[model samples]
Every structure is written in C-alpha cells, then in structure tokens.
Target: MAVQANFENIASYLQQFSHDRSIPPLEKWNPDYCGEMDLVIKANGEWWHEGRPIRRQKMVDLFAKILWKEQDDYFLKTPVEKIKIQVEDAPLLISAVDQVEIDGKQYLQMTTQNQDVFVIDAEHPIYMRAFDGEMRPYVKVRYELEALVQRNVFYHLVNYGELYDEPNCTCLKLHSGDAQFTLCM
Candidate 1:
C-alpha cells in the first residue's frame, strides 16, 4: 500500500523560479512524495448500503470504542485524520475532508480500514534531513504525528464545546510506554 498510494499535498507547494529547461531535475526543488495506507473497518450489524446487509454494527462499534475511543495509535488516537468508510458496499474509501481543518487549511488524511494498521519501523532519512530539529525513528514519527493530532484534536474538541475537557497528551507516551510515566487517565 505504501508504494501504491498518493501524497495528499500536505507539504508546502513546490516552487519553480523559472521554467528553465536546462535545469537538472535534482537541482530543481523537488520533494519526494510520502506514501499512505488506508483502513476500512467493519462490524457485524445490519447496514443499509445502497440497501444490503453487510457486517454488523457491533464490530464497527467495537473498533471505534476499543481502538479509537480507547486512544489506540495505528487505530485512531494516532495521527490519522479524515477517517471515513465506504459503508453499504464491498469496502471502499470514505472521504472526510468537508469539515476538518489544520493550520487554516483542509487536507486529506491517510488511514487503513478493514486491516490491522502498523507503523513504519523507521523514519525516512529525508524527513530527518528536512525537519532537522529532532532525530525521530519510524516509531517516533507516529508519536510526533499523534502529538500534532493531539494539538489539533484538542483545539477542535474545545471549539465544538461538546467536549468539556481533555487530558494532557504527549508524543513520548505514544511511542513506547516503556519505562517512562505517561500522564495516564
């Protein structure tokens, strides 16, 4: 899935000072595209897809409650955004970009449905070189992602007012809850 996917333009748009045909591709500003994976979740319940009985609701709710609400990374509490499912059909992508926004912008988020999601074991060398400040491994990337997500979600939850309050979340805890004491609920 990583090799056969698309980049949703999260990076700042590329700039070409001038269309110099003599310019080498490597010399020109070009950013490698990052691949994404999607998940399609289903449960054992009566669902009316175009009008058909598919998986049950219990299964869907189970995923949402356990992985998502329970705050499981690679599940929901991860850095993923714009999660939607192609319900009532033989599994499809559900676009959730109509509402969610980040840094005054809206973008498509990567996700995996109907499959057990896994984080990449190491960070891309390019990310390390570009982002600079932090030396993040693949596992660390997920935490950093979740940290960004935590901030955005925190702000959104606050604006919605539906959520009165939220607990403090950090990137370190999301990576590997080894010997460190995370601010647990």
Candidate 2:
C-alpha cells in the first residue's frame, strides 16, 4: 500500500481506540510489517514526518498509543499493519514529575509529553543509562517502551531523592511507595 493511503487508513482504524485514555492492546496485535514510514522521533521528543515536524498534537498522541517495540526497533502498529519508524533516543519523553502522598506514603509520579501518567514503582522504575556520552535517567512507560526523563524533570526529581552511601560509591536514592532506586551506582 502507498504510504499516504496506509497512513490515513491506520489513523482512521485507530480512531476507535483513541476515545479513552486506555492504551491499545498492541501486544495482542500480530500484524504484517508494512514496510517503513518516514517517521522519525528525534532525541528531543519531536515527531517529524518526511522532513517537517508533526505539529498536530492530537495526531502525535494518537500515534503514540500505537507505538510498539520489538528487539531494538520501534513501529506504529494497527490491527492489520505495522510500519517501522526511526527513534533517535527513547520513544517518549518524561515532561513532568511530581511527588504525591497517599496514606502517608510518598510516590513519584511522572507524566509523559503525551499526557500518559504513571507512578515510579517496581512496575515503572527509573534507571540510569548512557545517552550521548552522559549517563541519563529513564523510566519504563509500558510494554518495554521507555521515556527519557527530561533534564529539568530529572533535576526536580533529585530534590525528592536522598543520598545513600553504597559500599563502593555514594548514590542518589529515591523512594516511591515500596520501590527504591539508587542512581549513579
């Protein structure tokens, strides 16, 4: 199928699943690879198509819902088709962070650029990885997909972290609910 026709079909087919905030069951979807799309998610969290930035927030949000990852590649999947896309860094970006208390327990909540919110816990723990020669923080969003914690959000999160002295090195420890993450280990 041509790229434009396929793109419109995918968008229209996915519209039904976009009404609510729940994510589509991409894991259960087994579609044939429909070649590649000229879609590139840049390291800075901008979605570009062809050579121009995709300025439509709604379209970006809809596409984010269908994002799937296999091995090291990313794809936009529908019920019948899957198109590979390029990702310079992590597919999503953690745009904001907040510390919320519930029943006297603290939890770190992260919001992605697409407005997907998740708590930092065992299910979505933050980890350090080397990106562009610097160790940066990332949190798992869902289905093996991760969001690169923005630098400003990372700094804001640091305020809620405490210093811990490991046996070999000192690390920054962040506690959220029952999960504890040690950074710079």
Candidate 3:
C-alpha cells in the first residue's frame, strides 16, 4: 500500500516535467529508501528492469530524470522514494557531440543517450582510462555521474585534439575555451 502510494507520487512529480528539458530537482528530494529495484543500466547504456529491456524512449528518459548517485551507488529518487539500481559501467552514454567556436574560443558540447547536454568545461571535464590496453573516455554529466564517450564519438574527438607542448613532453589535449583537458599522458 505504501509502495503504491509512493509510486503514484513519483509518477505525478515526473508528469510535471514531462515536456520540460530541464532536469528535475532531485537533490532537493528527501525520499524514503524503497529498497533495491531490478533496474539495471548496462555497460552500453541500456536501461533494464525485471530482467527485461525497457524499450520505450520516453519511459527511459523519464527514468533517467530521477536518476541519482550517492557515494558510488545509483538510485531512482523521487520525493517519496529512493530505489537503488545497478549500473554496469556508467548511467548514460555520450551518443553525440556538437562543437562550436565563440570569440575564438572552442566549446565542445556533448549529448547523452537520454538527451541530456553537457559542455566539456571546468565543471564537466573529460577523462580517459585505459582498460585492457584500449583507451576509454568519459565525460562528466551531472550529479557526479559520467557518460561513457562512445567509440565513434571518441574518434571524432580525436580529430579535434591538438598536440600541445608541455614542460616535459608533447601530449594531445582537447580544448574548450581556456580550459584544456589532456586526452593522453
């Protein structure tokens, strides 16, 4: 009974931001722990629940809205409930990138699989990690969550990377305005 009521409240709150692109104020929510959910965000950024894939884009986007992270764990949070969810790699994937130049400064903006846009700047920096001798890149999304930069998107970013001369050696760096993010060591 309480779980049903909490789900109703969560649904109502989600409805309020159904058409809005801005993310809901999840940080302000103080929901009760609703235990673990079957929801799992796979390494490829597919959302699943009850061992089945969630196929509807709109529904997936709605779930992504309520996604929250706490000290390395992911949860679907609302004003009345906080349900833990499994994340194989990242909560989302960087599906596309849009680059622009303003006043001679370059800006790289990336869009997540859930349609959330983030600019690669100080607040949202890109980091690369080597896994099995392959380079994997990630960009900070929000709420301490990061989106894995897809392979094709990473190749595109490599085209924009410039060779920078550091004090010790030359390294490849991606630039956005005055901020320079080293792509490689």
Q: Which candidate is the best by TM-score?
A: 2
| Predicted candidate 3 versus true structure: per-residue lDDT over 1-185, tens digit per residue | 45445545566778878898888888898988988776789988888777889898877888888889999899989877898889988888999987888787779989988899878999999998764566678888889888899989987887788876777655668888788899764
* TM-score for each candidate, following the candidate numbering: 0.17, 0.92, 0.86
Better by lDDT, candidate 3 or 2: 2
lDDT of 1 by residue, 96-145 (tens): 11133456543223222322233222331101111135332121212222
Select the stronger candidate by TM-score from 1 and 3: 3
Order of quality (lDDT) = 2, 3, 1
Local accuracy of candidate 2 as per-residue lDDT tens digits, 1-185: 88788778888987886777888899999999999888999999999988899999888999999999999999999889999999999999999999999788999999999999989999899999988998888999998999999999988987999876878866788999988998974
Give the per-residue Cα lDDT of candidate 3 at 111: 93
lDDT of each: 0.25, 0.91, 0.83
RMSD of 3: 3.2
TM-score comparison, 1 vs 2, better candidate? 2
Q: Which residue runs does candidate 2 get wrong by more than 4 Å?
A: 164-170
Worst 10 contiguous positions by lDDT, candidate 3: 1-10
CA shift at 150, candidate 1, in angstroms? 26
